[model samples]
Target: MIGFSCYLSEPADEQQTAYLKQMQQAGFTGVFTSLQLPEDDPKTLRQRLNHLITSCHQLGLAVVADISLASLKRLGIAPRDCSGIEALQLDGVRIDDGIDMTTVAALSHTMGVALNASTLSAETIDQLANAKANLRHIEAWHNFYPRPETGLDPCWFQQKNHWLHTLGFKTMAFIPGDAQQRGPLFAGLPTLEPHRGLLPLAAYLDLKRLATDHVYIGDPQLSPRSIAAFQAYTSDQVLLIQTQTADDRLYHLTWHNRPDVAQQVVRLAEARLEHIFAAPEPHHTDERPRGSITLDNTRYGRYAGELQITRCDLPADPKVNVIGHVAPVALPLLDHVGPHQALRFKQ
Candidate 1:
């Protein structure tokens, strides 16, 4: 299930409601929100949460609140208590911090529990297993780092996700949003820390190949263009490409490369498509990186029509036109495309 984050600091205005509706239209099924109760006026906080929760429910979207022990303590709430869950119309809670297996197990009975995906260790999993935690109501999710260069490593992310699966928990991770970013650099927080520079749609599609059950945009909001790209990707309407200087030749030529699922690289026969946009053949073919598409010069000459997507970084060749690379974070999705999958470009 794809989800998005909405900070409590943001207001619940009609614009926000419209954003949520747009997300729903774009194939998002869930949202993550944070809650903090005030000592002076609990009513105000309640009203805020109530409004947001009601709005999400109206759009058929589920809401999960981010909570920590400190927040619970501030609210004077019990670790396993869920007294106002129904009233608030919350679907679940993401226990961001202060994890105790026994308490987590107890909390599972009353409400759905989402553990920190990035922090769950083998020892913790064993403890939870020994405590007989309700795995059904429990899930794992990685937190987004608000600061730059603080996101988790992709290698470790895959390892952790695989580990969580063995323990019967589906894992969720986040990718930064490129549009309407909400942070220091105007790039949303992403679980794969390195993905802060990637296009939001490309990042989302890339993470899908890593077996992440849920992928969310870590920003408070996304732009309309980003929203539309996500919607198109979900519907298998396009392959979002982030082109570089080397890829200018292919980037300007907009012929769809139909995915050949069996081969992992979609083949675009330049000979078949009349509109090559008069792209010049590569004077020099460079090293082809995975997600890099190479224009085949020998197969069809200067009008080199054949394009191949590299599964991994390949040696640079003078014969083929190595135009651009598929953004690194989005590379994992190359293999999952159905045969004849459509493609799209974003420069």
Candidate 2:
């Protein structure tokens, strides 16, 4: 199924409901929302999110929400303080920190929502296993860790493949490669229909070679070229091409002045593809890094301060301490001590 991230930005509940319904009709299987709670007042946040969850459930759509330690810290509470409320909202908790397992597990128990860890790591997997929590899935880019040999390590590919099979976890990998790279990646993993941003015509055609079960065109503003390309390639082969409204300030400045162009693009693309979904806005954090390095560093630190070093000072003793007993300085011993030997004896 395809889905879009939903941001409850509208002031009125009626508008929010209408917007969600529109998204549901647009072919989104799920919606991701951001519910911020006060650290000292998680109960209030829980109440708000509960309402949103109930609303989505009524629409017969799955809902996912973000729960971050930093967001809690802003409310002046720690993860422990929000455990009870988290358990109450537990459809999914965005795993931003390594220490959120306890709260996530508690929330999962109460709300029956599986945890979806974003930007996951080996350590996070171990933590989830230790907590005995069922992790829903991981959201990552396919070219996260670049390999020197193949540009992406086949070994890492094998590891993730094995891990997914053993752990029964789903992976969502986004790719923005040209047609050449996209074809092989998609053909290699038929089950993984990656979410991709805009690409050139050549690359888009390459994507057509493989059965593109799902496609996400991030640009809201419709371009003549993009619309034409969508119409040309997305016939019967592609499943869905989800697009968002281009109402942001940046989208207007960069793409075009028309804010509604995004919707127009999606509409046109859908007309061509037949299977298209639309959302009022994009759910992803605007703070997305340009590259994998930024994403990795944001999730993990170098641990420079945690590293330790050891050093030793050598003595300037002239006498040879070769024997067990300390001997008086002797001319013969000094003659035997060459420059190299003397340097070694200094230790």
Candidate 3:
């Protein structure tokens, strides 16, 4: 499942509601919110939580809250008395530290519960099982590290996920958002340290490769371009790559990678078949770096009109014209494109 975050640090407003709807329309299925923010007023938290939940329900988005014993107490909701939680109509609740195993097991029966994936031990699993927890509704969610260099290591995360799967738990992780990053430390929030500065889509794809069942945006907002890219990828199976220089000849067309994938670059399937560009001489035969969008000239004989996006840096070639480069935000996306992958260029 794909999701995004919304926080209660401030009251919900028209803009926040619109953002939720916008994200829902863009193919996000769920939202992750926290009820334990240190700065929120107890009264205001209740009001904002109600507004957020109502909006999510109307939009068909699942709501999950990250909560702790103190936060629940501040709201006057007891650990055992989940009726208050149920009244909020949340699809799930994430249990933070200081919440006991019995409470975790109880909450599972009442609503979906997400345990910390990194710290959940075999002993705790045994304890929950012995407590007769409804394990079917349980999932493991990794925390998004706010501090730089503190995020989980990729290898260790993968190994932990393998074990979690063996114990029959689905896994979720977080990736940073590019637009309006969450503050305090205005750096990105990511489950994997290496993903901190990467684009959200790239970080998400990496998590998928690592066997994550769900991925959420750790920050509260995503740039409109990123949202559109996600919408295109999910709805039409196309990667919408933003370009630095708009080539009128190529920007309006949809391109596909060759079925027989190349080793160093993505070969455009239709480029060779179409007699589009004039039989020409290469003018900008500059060094073709990764993400360079190039078109072969007539100097290459039958290979003319072969358009490709370089996957790795290569020396300049007189036969190829570097027309443009994919926008830096989308450079990481090149690594995920495979054979026959549909790609569309956007300004």
Q: What is the TM-score of each predicted model, taking all chains together?
A: 0.76, 0.41, 0.96
Worst 10 residues of 2 by lDDT: 289-298
Q: Write the per-residue lDDT of candidate 3 for residues 1-347, one digit (tens) a residue.
A: 99999998867889998999999999999999998876778888889988999999999999999988888888888876767767777899998857888878877887899999999998999999999999999999999999999999999999999999999999999999999899899899999999998988889989999999999999989999889989988888899988876568888788999989898999998877777666668779999989999988879998888889999999999999999998877899999889889999998
Please give, for residues 280-338, the per-residue lDDT of candidate 1 as tens digits.
Answer: 45555877767886666653555456666777667877667766667665565565456
CA error at residue 171 for candidate 1, angstroms: 0.2
> CA lDDT of each candidate?
0.72, 0.36, 0.90
The model with the greatest TM-score is: 3
Model 3 steric clash total? 0
Model 3 / residue 29 / CA error / Å:
0.7
TM-score of predicted model 3? 0.96
Model 3 bad stretches (over 4 Å): none
Off by over 4 Å in 2: 13-15, 36-51, 73-78, 81-83, 86-90, 110-119, 135-166, 173-347
> Where is model 1 more than 4 Å wrong at Cα?
36-42, 85-87, 129-132, 183-187, 241-266, 269-339, 345-347
Candidate 3 at residue 11, lDDT? 71
TM-score attained by model 2: 0.41
